[model samples]
Target chain A: MKVTESDDVISFAGGLPNPISFPIEALKASANHAITENGSRLFQYSSTQGYAPLREYIAAKYQRVHGLDIHADDVFITTGSQQALELLGKVLIDKGDGIVIEEPGYLGAIQAFTLSEPTFYGVTLENDGLNLEELEHALQQPNVKFVYTVPNFQNPTGLTYSKEKRQQICEIMAKYDDVALIEDDPYGELRFQGEPLPYIGAGKLENSILLGSFSKTVTPGMRLGFIITKNKELMQHIETAKQATDLHTNIFSQYVIYDYLANNDYMEHVQKIIALYKNQADAMLNAMEEFFPAHVDYTRPEGGMFIWATMNNGASAVDVFHKAMDQNVAFVPGDPFYTSKTGVNTMRLNYTNATPEVIREGIKRLGSIL
Target chain B: MKVTESDDVISFAGGLPNPISFPIEALKASANHAITENGSRLFQYSSTQGYAPLREYIAAKYQRVHGLDIHADDVFITTGSQQALELLGKVLIDKGDGIVIEEPGYLGAIQAFTLSEPTFYGVTLENDGLNLEELEHALQQPNVKFVYTVPNFQNPTGLTYSKEKRQQICEIMAKYDDVALIEDDPYGELRFQGEPLPYIGAGKLENSILLGSFSKTVTPGMRLGFIITKNKELMQHIETAKQATDLHTNIFSQYVIYDYLANNDYMEHVQKIIALYKNQADAMLNAMEEFFPAHVDYTRPEGGMFIWATMNNGASAVDVFHKAMDQNVAFVPGDPFYTSKTGVNTMRLNYTNATPEVIREGIKRLGSIL
Candidate 1:
C-alpha cells in the first residue's frame, strides 16, 4: 500500500508533531471557558484585525524572547504560517518575479509561492545557513522580488545560521534597495543546543517579514500563526491580501490560544517538548552512527524535526526509500525539497514523532536497505 | 461615533445571523464529543481534501435536499464561503480575464475577485434575475470568461430567479462554448416565503460550479463551507489552490460540524433560523411600508438576510446612509456592489441579526431622518 493508504503506516512524510504531546486537558479547559464565558464574541464575525489580546501577547513574547521590538499593530494573525506565506506571495510577487529560496526548503512554501507563478532561484545551503555567494548571485537577478529563508533549524536541512552569518545576510539585504526578505522562523524556539542566535529580521534590516508559528510549540491543527513586518506599507498590503483571502483567521482558535497562553506555563510545556524531541534526535543520530556506512553524511541538528542525509558515491535516495518502505520504514526523499537539477542522493529523516525504540528500529531497517 | 465604532448600534450592515438563534448548547456538546472521542485526530494535521465524514455528509445533504448527485470526492471544504470565492478567483481568473457579475452583487464576492484584477462586466438585474439582454451583451465581449450569480436570494437584491429564467440563463451559458458559470448559493437554505426553485447548476450544463456554506445555517464563526464542481480538471486546480491557500480548513471545526450533523437534527435547526429571520424580515418590510416616503421602493424578499431599497427620485444612497447613521440606524450603501459606471440609488438592509422590535424601531428612526 502507498503512504496515503492507511493511518497505521509508520509514516515520516508528514510534518506533524506527536499527538501525545498535545495539551489536551488544557485545550479542553480553554474550549469550555471560551464557549461559556465569551460565547457571543467567539461566534460573532470579528474584526479583520485579529483578536487583540492574542496579538498583544504574541508581540510581547517576540520582544522578550527574541529581542525584536514589534508592536501589536505589526502582527497579523493567520490561519497558519501556510496562509502567511500565501498572503505574502500574493502581495509581493508579480508575474515572472524572482523568488530566492534555499535549495532544500519547505515544500509547503514552494506550493504557496508557485500559485503566484514567480520565477524560482535556488540558493545553496552551507552548514551555517544559505550560501552567501549563491544568495548574492540570485539577488543580482533583475526582477528578484524577495529571498525566502528558514534561518533557524530549517525543515529538511536541520541547519541554523550562525549570528555572524545572519548579520552578513542582513547587511547584504540592506544593501539591496528593491528586494525584501521573508524570514520564516517556525522552528526557532525548539533549540536544544548552543545559545539562541538573533533572527535575520532582528537588527537593522527594515525590509523584512517575519513569520512565526505556535504549531511546533503547541499544536499544528489549531492552524494558528502570525506575520510581522516593520514596514507599514508592506503590512497594509498583506492585511488587504488577508481580507481578500479568508476574511480573517479563525477567531475561536485565536481566543483559545490566547486563553491558554494567559493561564498556563507555556514555557514549561515547550521545554518538555524540547526534551522529548532532543532525546529522539539523539537516538536517531546514535543509530545512524552505529549502522550507516562510513561515507554516508548527515547533519546533527541542535533542534527541530529533520536530519538531511546524503549517500556517498551517488547512491540513489529514491531506491533506498522504496526498499525501506517494504520493511514499514519510511522517510521523505530529499529531491522534492530542492528546486535545482541535482537531488538524487539525499533524503530527510524526522525524529520528532517517533519513540526512541521506533527511531532505533526504523534507522536500523533503513540502514539494512541502504 | 461611526457605525463601525460600536456593536450596540442598530446594524443592518453586517452579514450576520441572529445571535439568539445560535445552537450554542448543541455546538458545545458536539465540541466536547469531538475533543473527547477524537482529540488526537482533531489536533493533528488532516487531509487537504477535508474531514471525510463531513464531506460525505455534505454530499449526501446536497443529493437529498437539492436533488443534485454530488459525491464526497467532488467536494472541497473551505474555511468559509468567502474562502471558496477566493479559491475560485485564484484558480479561474487570470489577469485581464473577463468575469460577468450581477450589477448589485455581494460585496464580498467583488472583494474576493478583485485580487486577480479581472475585468468585470455587470449584467443588469431585473425583478426576476439578471436581465437576459444585458447578460447576452456582456457575454458577447471577446474572451468573456465566466458569469457569477446568486440564483436564490441574492445578497443585496434578495431576488430569486424564476424557474424559466434559470433555464434561460443556463441555456445561454451552454451556447457560449467557452464561458463558465459560478452559482454561489450561501442563502439558498434560508427560504421562508417562496417555493423551492432548481439551482442553475442542477441541469445539463457541465461547466457550472456551485458554492454552499453552513455559515448562515449552522454558524458563521465555524467557517465551514464547500464547493461542488462537475468539471474534474477545474476541481483539481481548485484543490491545488486550496493547498496553497490554507493547507486545509480547521480540522476541529470540521469534526465538530460533522458530529453535530450526525447526532442532532440539522433541518429542524435550519427551520428555527428561517422562522426567526422570516419574522424579522416581515417587521422590516412592515415598518418600511408604514414609514418610508411614498416614492421609495424596496424588494419584498422571499428569503435571506437583505431587502434592496431604492430611494425616491434617484437620491444618493450614501447620503441616506449618513442620515440614517445620524439616527442610530446603519446599512450598506449599494454603489460598491455595482461593476458599472452608473450609481445605484439603493441600499441593502439585513433583517437577520436584529430583533423584530429593534428592526421596526430602527427603520422608523431612519424614516424620520430621510
Candidate 2:
C-alpha cells in the first residue's frame, strides 16, 4: 500500500514545488562563492541565532512583504518551519499543557508538537478560516499555551483566513492575556488570485509568533526557516533550545543561501513558482468540475499546493484511497490531519508537484474513482 | 566575553578540527556531482531516517572500522551529533529521569539534556576514563535511563577509556535491564598514539547506542551524524522524533558527504589530522612544562583537539580567563563543563587549530596570566 506508484501512475500525492522552478545554476554559483569567500567560517561553528546577513534579509523581507516590524534580532533561523514547531513545543509546552489547533490542522505541526505531550483542543474550520466562535472557546480554556494556525494557504486545506477574521482574532486574543497565537505562514507568498490578507499574528505581535519557511519558494533541501516574534525573552529561550537541538542549522547551507540572496532576486523566482502552481491548480479544479459527480465536492483554492475535498456520498476516504491506488492515482486521506478523529470522507490532493497535463489527468482519474 | 580574541591572540578555546584538514576541493567536487546526478532528489524532501545510501555507508563503516555488526536499518542520520544528543534526550528522557554524565562532561550534552529536566548523576572522571565505581553505582540507580560518555579523547578532557574499562562497562550495563549506555565517539577516529580501544557500546549492542559524526573528521558545517543501535524499535522512535526536529538533516549535505566518502580515502585524511594534532599537543604540553608555574598542572593528550588543565593554586578560572583575554591569549574556563558546578580552576585548551609555534606562545602567555 505504501509502494511508489509506477511511472504511468498520475500521482497527486506530494505537495512538492516544481523541480524545474529552481534556478540551479544560480544556487550552484552561490555555493561556490560561499566556499571561496567565507573560507573556514563557512565550515566552523557559527552563532546559534544564525548567520546575521541571512537573518537580516529575512527581516527585511518580512517588513516589506507583510508590513511587519521584524528586526534582524527578532528572527531566529531554524532547520525548517517544522523545527520551529518543535522548538515552540520545547520552549512553551509542558506535559498536559493545553494546545489549541484547528480541526483538520497541518499534520506536520501536529507531529512536531505531540512529543511535548500537550493535550490538544481543536477549533472547527469554516470555508473562510477557523470558526471564530469555537476558536474563542478553545483560547479561553485553562492552561491553553497557544492557538496555532497557518493563516495563508494552509496545508491539507486550501483556505486562507479573511481580513475581517484576522482582525477579530487579534481582538479575541487580546482578551485572553495568557494565551498566545502562532501564525505559521509557509505559503503566504503563493497567492494566485486573491488579495493577500494581513496575518492575524502580525497585527498582534506581542501575543503571537510567526513562522516562515524557504522550503516552498526556494529549495527544501537547504532546509531553512525562521521564527519571528517581538518577544526577546521567547527568542532567547528558543536560541538556547536551538543550541541543544543542532547547535545551529547547517552553517554551510546558511552561507549558500546568503550568497544566493545577495546575487539573485529570489522574489522574482517566487513569482515564477506562483505562476506555475496557479496553472496546475486551475487544471486540477477544472478537471474535477467536469468529471466528478455532484456528490463529491472540493475547496476551490485561490492559491497554494492543496485541494481539500469531502465526499457527500457515503464513501470512506481510506477505501477510496485503495481504489484510487488501483486506478494509478494517489492523495492523502485527511483523517490524519485532524487533532480529533473526524474527516472520514475527506482527502487532500496536491496540485503543485505535477504539471497541468499530469494534474488534469490525475484529477480525471480520481474523479472517475470517486 | 564572546570576543574572538584578535589575530594576535593565540587562542586555545575551540575544539575545532583544522580547516586545512579537510579536502575542500574533493568536497566541492562531491557537491557538484550530487547536484548533477541527483538533480531534484538532492533538492527534494527525503526519508525521515536519512538518505539511504549515506546510512548504508555509515553502517558499513561501523562494521569495517569498529567490527560492529550494524545493519543499515539500525542507523538514523541527524543534523549533527549535537542533535543526536537532543534526540536522545527527547526519546529517552522524562522529567526527573536519571542521566549519568561525567563530572566535567561535554557542555553541549549538558545544555541539550537540561531542557528535559533530567536528574543528573555525574561520575568522577579519572585520568583514564569515567571512574568505574561511580559509573557502576550510577547505572544501578533507580530510573537511570542512560550513562552518556565520550569514551575516546573526550571533549574538554582529552581522555580515552582503557580496553579493560570498556569491557567492565559492558558487563555493568548488562546487569541493568532499565539502564542503557550511550558511547559518543566523535573523536575515536583521531586517536594518534594509543591503541584503539573497543567501543563499550559497540560490544554491548542491545543495551547501548553509539553516536558517530563527520563533523570533527570532515567538516562541522555540513552537520552530519548518526545513531547506531541494535534495537530497531528505538531507532524507529528516533526517526519519528527527527521528523519533528528538522524533517531530516539537509539532503544536499547528505548527498555531498556520501559522494565524497565514495570517492576519497577519508581514513588517510584522518591520519594526517592525527599527525598534525599530535605534534601540536606535544608542543602545548612541552610549553606548559617549561613556562607554567609548578602549581599548575595539565594533561599530556595523545590525540584529538583538547588538553584539560588545572591550576592547583586557589585562582579562579574565570579570573584567569579574563586576565588571559587581556593578554591576548584565550582558553575556555572549565566551569561550564561541570554538571554540578564544582570545577572553578580547570580550563580546556585546544591545540589542533594552530601551529606548534602558536601553541607554545599561547600557553606561555596563559601560564603567566595564571
Cα lDDT for residue B229, candidate 2 = 84
Per-residue lDDT of A140 in model 1:
91
- Candidate 2 on B3-90: residue-level lDDT in tens? 7446877789877788888778788888888888888788777788898999999988889877888889988899999999999998
The parts of candidate 2 lying over 4 Å away from their true place are A4-8, B4-8
Query: Clashes in model 1: which pairs?
Result: none
The TM-scores that each candidate's chain B achieves against the reference are: 0.97, 0.97
Report i-RMS for every model: 1.0, 1.2
**lDDT tens per residue, model 2, A66-89:** 788888999999998899999999
Could you tell me the C-alpha RMSD of candidate 1 in Å?
1.9
Tens digits of per-residue lDDT, candidate 1, A1-370, equal 1472355546566567877779888987888888888886776667676899999998998899878888999888898899999998999999899999998888899999988889999988889988999988999997998999999889888999888899899988888857888889998888888888878755467787889898888788878989888889988898788887778887777878899899899989989888998998999999999889887899999889889998886778888778887888888888888876554898888888778988898888888877
* TM-score per model over all chains: 0.97, 0.97
In terms of lDDT, the best-performing candidate is 2
Compute the lDDT of residue A249 as modeled in candidate 1: 81
Supply the TM-score for candidate 1: 0.97
